[model samples]
Target: MSDFVTPVLLMQTLAAVREAGRIITEAWEKPRSIKYKGPIDLVTETDVAVETFLGKRLREILPEANVLGEEGSPAARPEGTTWIIDPVDGTTNFAHSIPQCGISLALWRNDTVEMGIVYLPAEDELFHAVRGEGAFLNGKEISVTDESDVEHALVATGFPYSIREDIDIVMQNLRAVLMTTQGVRRFGSAATDLAYTACGRFDAYYEIRLKPWDLAAGWLLVEEAGGKVTLYDGVTPFDFGKGILASNGKVHKAVAALITDTDD
Candidate 1:
């Protein structure tokens, strides 16, 4: 693994994600052709269009790197250098005319994330992190909050699509956090929530049932910003199957304890 990522490659990936965000935002502004993958899971024409655009762009720049996107790619584990993307992070919000969505992109080399970018087109905020390098937001260095007390921290979280089918588990977890934290928010986009946490806008975040495309980029960003990311049991947050618990290092243990207590 190389110790440095060229600014050119980073810029290229950022541009691609930005371009994809623009395409999704444009489609979002107008009426969209929507489809259902399941009862609550949604897919929009823009989702496919953006993924195609991103896959093609990334391939042009890093042809050897495998691409895994939310709308495309096989179920194979990413090998060598792989780019995992979520063209539109909040498809549910996009379909409903809410502007709280963005694009997420991450490059993994040898099973570890080398770089990641999250772009919020509506806000024009770009969050990025390169391995061994610090995290940034709009070219300015950013860091996690110093808040250590879980009771004083503002936390964010999300419910999985299985909430309807597993309502009891979801509600119990939600209630646990709500009663413990100073504040709680559910933004429908795990990428954005994690990005926000990295920049100190949120002190911590946790959720169950997320995909690689959902947390790949944001995980690197949070860690680079001096935050902690792991499962509710305090394990590394690399599993695509289980959910995650992330905080600014200070409150991680407290948050993990709360989550596990809720489970118990």
Candidate 2:
């Protein structure tokens, strides 16, 4: 593989993400123009504006690369040197002026992630990770927690937009997780959930039916920070269209049990 991970490239990616994040915060300050992709899935004008702007910025950073952004790239797949972007990860939270939204960008190639970034404009936090190197938050190295006991671990999760159909399983897993862990939180933003897992604020996170842009950047973040990312099965490789169970390595199997095949 060619060298896509460099100080210069990471710097450029961060600048673009921070620049794009401004749109998220700016929109939160105004009345949102909303539309529904489904009964529960939301789209705001700012989501489109940020993705459009960020996609162009990323292409400039790697002119030969493909840009697959959630807002516009419905039919696009991960081609050579693809940059996957979620312009605003928590559109509902953003539309409601909630402060938990963020922007996620990842560079994927040859069936692997090369680099990833998740920027929370409201908190002014920029988290990043490269494939072999460890993860970072605001240029400082970071890692997942050392927590090993499920009874003391703080886990996070998000509901699917297809909640109505998935509710039975959702509640089953939710109930299992709640009974197994110290606490469970629903942040409405998978990027935030994964970022928190990476930085040790959360011991683990799990959610079903996430999109490519949702898991691309944050998956690398968790693993690079000394955590684990996988499907509920605990052995299968996780990808864009798969459900995820991400946790500090010590608690991965334990958490996986609760969210995966817990008996009712």
Off by over 4 Å in 1: 1-4, 235-237, 261-264
- Runs of candidate 2 exceeding 4 Å displacement: 261-264
TM-score of each: 0.95, 0.95
lDDT of 1 by residue, 42-100 (tens): 98998899899999999999988889889897664566788998888989988887767
lDDT of 2 by residue, 1-264 (tens): 227688898888888888898888777678889999999898989999999999888889889889888989875458788999998999898887777888989899889999989998998999999998899999999999999998999999998888888888999889998988999999899999999999999999999888889878999999899998888877677766678989998988888787753222
lDDT of 1 at 155: 90
**Best candidate, lDDT:** 2
What is the RMSD, in Å, between candidate 2 and the native fold over all Cα?
2.1
